[model samples]
Target: MKLSVWTYEGPPHVGALRVATAMKGLHYVLHAPQGDTYADLLFTMIERRNHRPPVTYTTFQARDLGSDTANLFKTACQNAYERFQPQAMIVGASCTAELIQDDPGGMAETMGLPIPVIPLDLPSYQRKENFGADETFFQITRALARPMDKTPQITCNLIGPTALGFRHRDDITEITALLSDLGISVNVCAPYGATPQDLTRLGAAHFNVLMYPETGEAACRWMERELNLPFTKTVPIGVGATHDFVKEVATLTGVEPTLDTARLRLPWYSASVDSTYLTGKRVFLFGDGTHVATAARIARDEMGFEVAGLGCYNREMARPIRALAREYGVEALITDDYLDVEQRIETLAPELILGTQMERHIGKRLGIPCAVISAPVHVQDFPARYSPQMGIEGANVIFDTWVHPLVMGLEEHLLHMFREDFEFHDDAGASHHGHKAKPRPDPEARQPVTADEHPGTVVWLDDAERELKKVPFFVRGKARRNTESFAAEKGLSQIGIDTLYEAKAHYAR
Candidate 1:
């Protein structure tokens, strides 16, 4: 019921089109304009799907906004149906099209087509990509659930299954392996291999497995209510979690699951111990709650790193995340306010910052080595082969990223201390940093900042940098202004160079 159902924790647009691209024998008639269709690039350039979103954009322009748009939409739909004899048709709209309220759902029903039609009411402004994904999957499941009947008891549907990240294929393989080992057969994985018949047989599965938190809840509930097919909420990420998941599934399915699948060739306990050099390495944490929670376990248990601070700009997902944060004895800083995150950086002073693309810039400015732990990851997250964050190899990846960033344990701490600007504080309670916390400023003593504080070379397109100054935070304004002023003094652009001089020199006094 929370808005998190529609809110995304990362780049809302990541790999969206990849879903459409992977699904053949499906036609997508987007109720969007020309520019909105560009989502196809995620597949063409990033995920590298051969075709685009199985789409036919309405191509409605500013001119068509006034005309019989319904007719235009009808034509597009008819043409699409003719061109692609799809098993199913997806009728969807982006943010702009939602305003027009083109009820394709009603129209598709009246058409009396041979196949099913899924109407996606994904309002871009109010929601995000992950939410759209969940809702769409939900609607599609319901759509495919028409004229439902009972099925075999052994099969099960896989919820939250989308082909997006580089590791998706491997993760699926791993899940299949573990489930197969438990004798719980997978019923459908849609758009990958599952047929319409397979989708119809979804209720036949004993239950559903939700791999990701983003798209699982709605479909799980619907299946539970309609088909009495219950589901598991655990996201099998780390070693301990995976082991726990295997046990749980074994109990649920009433099968004696052998560790033959997850327990591989290598000695698990001894090998994990082999990577103990990574323990206590100061690590910064930020990302979506789901991935962040998983990362924390991987950092502490698997990778052997000590997390300094955990924060996420994605506030919508902070609920399930807080427990995970408290486990590490740190309250997560949940805000889109980048400066606050920066302040957290100063406080935790982690040797390595594991975060999103935005943190790449912050880490560079702060002189900390970093690797992107979660999304909004660019093409770089995917290596030549499938480098997944699953199984033993995932543990290895964690070990390498956490360890390569710094030397083991206290050495990393001493390095950050020596290199960073460590100042004395009185309270010593802000965070892990032993520095004394600064006293709050008296309201009466506070004054409006003057030109003297604004001294800096104003860089072209420095609006964003300047925007950081107006943040209500007293500390952030000071730091951003100071950095800008320093750049101005050096004739570099970021902040205006010497606000006083720039003004006075322009005037004839």
Candidate 2:
């Protein structure tokens, strides 16, 4: 695996922790070192979960590695089963423990536990968090699912949602309400609140609804192949997707779908004359595959934003992201490096950025506005409110989350017209938000360089810098860099207003 300061997803075993934490009576015995226990903070601190994750870590140190680490793992498993008394148990090893070649699954089996023991054979170096979650959920579902003698009903099992997901709890509620409105019943929702018995009844449902493509697709595909059950792979994030999702479910169940557009305020909000300014607003998107693709569709189709650039860090889902980028006539960035994503944002200079916490920092550095839309989230992303990113309510939330960062056309025009007025800034330290501005750097400490000060460097003329300030502050730095690069390419030593305009025209093409 590649080393990075920031990663969209953690190691595969962490994914198993997510599954164990999300379920009701499931426990995970992780054969890992003490350092690997840091993943617990992700759920407790970020998700604000009241209880600790349902995991028992071996936490073997260097001293234990020299001793009988295998026996330590067995003791941990026996203690976890006795203490938790879970209905089901999962056994796995972390990257460091895997090197020791101790079979954790086999040791757990020999313990003679009464409950079902699911073995997680995840290769930490070969896969990531999403893949691990998918494999674990698929294994659990396959092991517990039973053949039924009854006919199918107008019901479905919602698959692929778990703990620490981006607004997954509310998304499930929204989707459940939408289905209920159509007189459809939900048989089960797995890996979120389902028990071992709930998994056994999965075949009782008429079909399956694959909510998040990253974690649930594998399980749904397995069920379809084994049980001959049909499934829908639509993610209901935006207005159009929600509508399509409802229609698809209706078609699958042979029932007439009923949609109350008034319940979903996004269509009306987007059609309102006040929101006309949102048309053609440039947007940059980067996240996991599911949210990034959904956000791109919503930005371009519903909100009328020009998708300047879009990509994801989940390399396993690269093919679909590349297809999406091709649809927008842009190249997809498939990498786990946050620096590459930051460089792309600098090059795009979009008005609004929809991404994760890493992109939030990058946008702040570039003076751009951003809204967190995907996972690898911070505590703030899990707000203490009923905000969701799916179904009708989710559409309204998306409209507000994405639009609040941008300056309204009329407000911006007025600001530009009266920015020089003394009333705009008072000596009392009054500003737009009534906050005091920080002290500026001393000009004498770092003097500005003139064209004659440098021998071969391309310097910005006074008029050129002044004109560049007229551009949006978020993109001013990028504009200046681009103009200077263009001057250097043409072997020019000075960048005048004419040269700036030439560069702008060249980039505009």
Candidate 3:
């Protein structure tokens, strides 16, 4: 594998850990090297769980390679079953351990443990984290779910919501409440709060509600084919989508749709005079397929924003995102490389970015505002507050999460615009207090990065640079690029105030 500073997805075994750790009575035994144990810190530290994930690692070192590493895996599996006494166990090998070719799944089967031992054939080199999670859940469901009679009342299994999912804990609460209001009861919520025994009861539900398709679609489709259970396709993220979701549920369960949106404030807030500035704002979206698609629709249709760019890092989602991008008349970017994502953001110069934690860092470096909208997020995204990304309340949370960054960015821009004022200057300290502000580095003192360092090739004169500063900070980068391209087309070597105004008027037409 190529080495890089960041990655969108980990190897498949980590996905297996996500499913195992999210459940109540399932354990994961990973055949990996000692260094591979670092993955446990992800759930324990980032997710801030009180207990570590239910994972047992073989942790074989270099010295043990000459000897039998397979024996180490067998020992770990036996110890895991004995110590934890889980209802079921899943076994797999990490990317590094895969080179040894110990065949973890075959070894797990021969052990003949009293409890069910489901072997996971997660190919680290060929597959990724989401695929691993999907396949693992599918295998578990296929092995444990039995044919049975449906419940008397209309019920569905919330077939997704794993550990470390983007706001999955709260999404479950929101969706479950919405379903309860529609005269439907939930039979079980799998892979999150479910047990291995709950898998057997999965068939008792009349149908399933597929929340995040990336992690749950495989299992849901399998159930539809094997158990004759139908699942919902709509993801209730925004006001419009939530309404549509309720109607879809009505069609499936024969219950009249009851949309209780009295608590939703997004529609009223969006049309208010105070929010007019947000209209026509350009936004870039990059994340998982489901979030990117849902956020794009919300941004354009619900929030009155322009879709400057749209993309996803997951290759599995390329086709849908591409089609959506085509609908918006922009090329879709489908790649895992962070550098490619960063370069595209620079070219687009969107006023705001809704993406993963990686895009947050990219935004900060490029002086743009960003909000986290998908997985591969930081610890801060997992707030203690009950913020969800689905249901009626979720629309309110989305309004706040996506808009706050732009609002704060505007405040910072105003501060920069009036920095020359004695009262609002950087050294003026807190406006409400008389205390002296801390000494800050002077921007002029540092070696200025040339405008030529960016995408364009045109030079800028001192007067033109001062004139360009008058443009709002949010659109300043785009203005500069546009002026440069205009100058280049006219065969001008250097840009002046006249040229800047001329380019602006030309583009305004």
Candidate 4:
């Protein structure tokens, strides 16, 4: 809960619903109105979940807002418990309900439900969905934990598992396979095959493998302090980190360490090749601190990109990330302000913008190519195939997202060879004409070339997809359409406005 300078770009609670539905058996009882329930679409469309998130909304209308709010909650809870009979239950409230101060946690505790009741305080006003996810998992695990003597031994809970995770299936498969080879058992995965009953078993596990930092740090620390369970501080998004994650888990579990030659080495080679081209590419990054930190490492160390900009909307875990950003000689942008983040993007003007869905809009408005590296994901990120961003597979995804956007990649070589008549410009200002080029045209001027002037002329979409335009905050559809139309007329592909921005500037008009 902190300052958020800019209004959020997407609809509220959409991604959270995507996650709730993605998990097969999870149930979420929301305490809000009908608009809040539109989140179901996130699963159906983006996450492609055929089944609904086990969620029930109080569906409180303004008419019933005062008369039966408490009764509505009780009925919702009873019906949810009766219908779903979830092993673990989450009593969560959205930003709207948080204002009324119902204290669902207090209600759930007072009701004395049979299952483990996790009261989650996810005030949309104060925090983002990622924080809710991490807290939700932690609350569930803690709700199910038992006293130490009764805890299971050598068993560990795999943390940071959530709905529609970037590459959850692959991450779990690799880690589980690795641990199984050493005869280690995963007691429970917070969101996978886990229940209130399995929670007590969490105390038995000797350690926790924190797959993602933003989501797992709290639970991992609680487990360590409360149950003496150790956690591995490994970010398993690349080849080396994957290896280290495995090794560290082995050490904590007292199991013999082994490696999968195919799984481990191929990605390292792929990343190396990717780095060869992406090296020194100006890149900017933002997300939850954990993923942002991982992206910064891969962009700078593995991919040879210059971190022209770095920032995270989450400040709770900003210290370590901030300290690391210093290596690039740039101060980490740690603020909850989206406008501030946009301002930073404008100032840094990296060749590529690496950030959330919000920054994707910022990058588009700035006319820069971008890849959504973390949350606030788009439908594109959920390609038909299972592409994970953790373990070896994650390295592969990173390689593609980073190198594919550049003109210096293998495609550029093929283009050069194909059109041997065309000349190459190696100079930094080749396209800019010594920085005197006019900034992108106004969004309002994006009219189609007149029919009288150019009758029957055909304009392809890419032709209109390159120029910068003012992106309206919170109106995603308008922003996207406006950008696509402008880029088409320029004959050049999109440009990120960030590349032109000098630091120490705010996002004013």
Computed on alpha carbons, the lDDT of every model, listed in order, comes to: 0.63, 0.86, 0.90, 0.66
Query: lDDT value for candidate 2?
Result: 0.86
Report the C-alpha lDDT of model 1 over 346-422, residue by residue, as the tens digit. Answer: 76667678887667667777767777776655566655664556554455555555555554434534433333224
* Model 4, runs deviating above 4 Å: 1-26, 109-112, 148-154, 181-183, 263-276, 407-509
Better of 3 and 4 by TM-score: 3
Alpha-carbon TM-score of each model against the true structure: 0.72, 0.92, 0.93, 0.73
Best by TM-score: 3
Model 4: per-residue lDDT, tens digit, 99-178?
Answer: 77777778878888876677776657656666666666667667667656533446667887666666565668767766
Q: Which of the two candidates, 2 or 3, achieves a greater lDDT against the reference?
A: 3
Q: Per-residue error at 479 for model 3, in Å?
A: 3.1
Q: How many Å off is the CA of 283 in candidate 2?
A: 2.0
Residue 468 lDDT, candidate 3, scale 0-100: 75
Find the 10 residues in a row with the least total lDDT in model 4. 499-508
Candidate 1, which segments miss by more than 4 Å at Cα?
A: 1-19, 146-153, 191-197, 261-277, 313-316, 336-343, 407-509
